[model samples]
Target: MNAQFFGGPYDGLSLATAEVNRYGRVVSKRFKGQRVHFVLLPPLADWERVRAGEVDSAPKHPYELVKTGDNVAFHDADVNERFNEILRAPEEA
Candidate 1:
């Protein structure tokens, strides 16, 4: 399972996937010569539904690399808004 980042320092980068069944596991690794601290978010409440292809799509981000006092912190991603944003249409200029 690969992870994708959006609208942050790691935007457009694909990183290794963490254990989807487990949450709050801090993992340290390097990307592009820079050290990064991050963790995988908890699986959705209805992950079974997702796996069954019931939802429109799976989460684009299953983890987050939040910044905390000069170091990266593992935390839950804002999945609700992200889903809405995905369903929303872009406004015309």
Candidate 2:
């Protein structure tokens, strides 16, 4: 007998599916219990643009942006301690 387990680029990556609604909002519950959110950050090269107000900051939306719960992939890590730094709570700052 043989068996194969599902795999992805990274442990943080997963599969999910969602349905798009009006206003271009995709509603889904792939992260129902986890409450994961999606964040849209500007490109690193946009530093000057951002400082000049040309580039906008990440949108307020990220969580539950999708629901398909399929074909979605992500990766998480603590590279250079940067990830932990970002994970720090607001009050901790």
Each prediction's TM-score against the native?
Answer: 0.29, 0.26
Best model number under TM-score: 1
Note the Cα lDDT for every prediction shown: 0.43, 0.30
Q: Compute the lDDT of residue 66 as modeled in candidate 1.
A: 55
Deviation in Å, model 1, residue 55 alpha carbon:
23
- Model 1 TM-score on a 0 to 1 scale: 0.29
lDDT tens per residue, model 2, 16-82: 2221121113222222234343322233354346557775644222222223444333222222432
For every model shown, the clashing-pair count is: 0, 15
TM for candidate 2 is 0.26
> Model 2 residue 75 lDDT?
27
Model 2 gets an lDDT of 0.30
85: Cα error in model 1, Å: 24
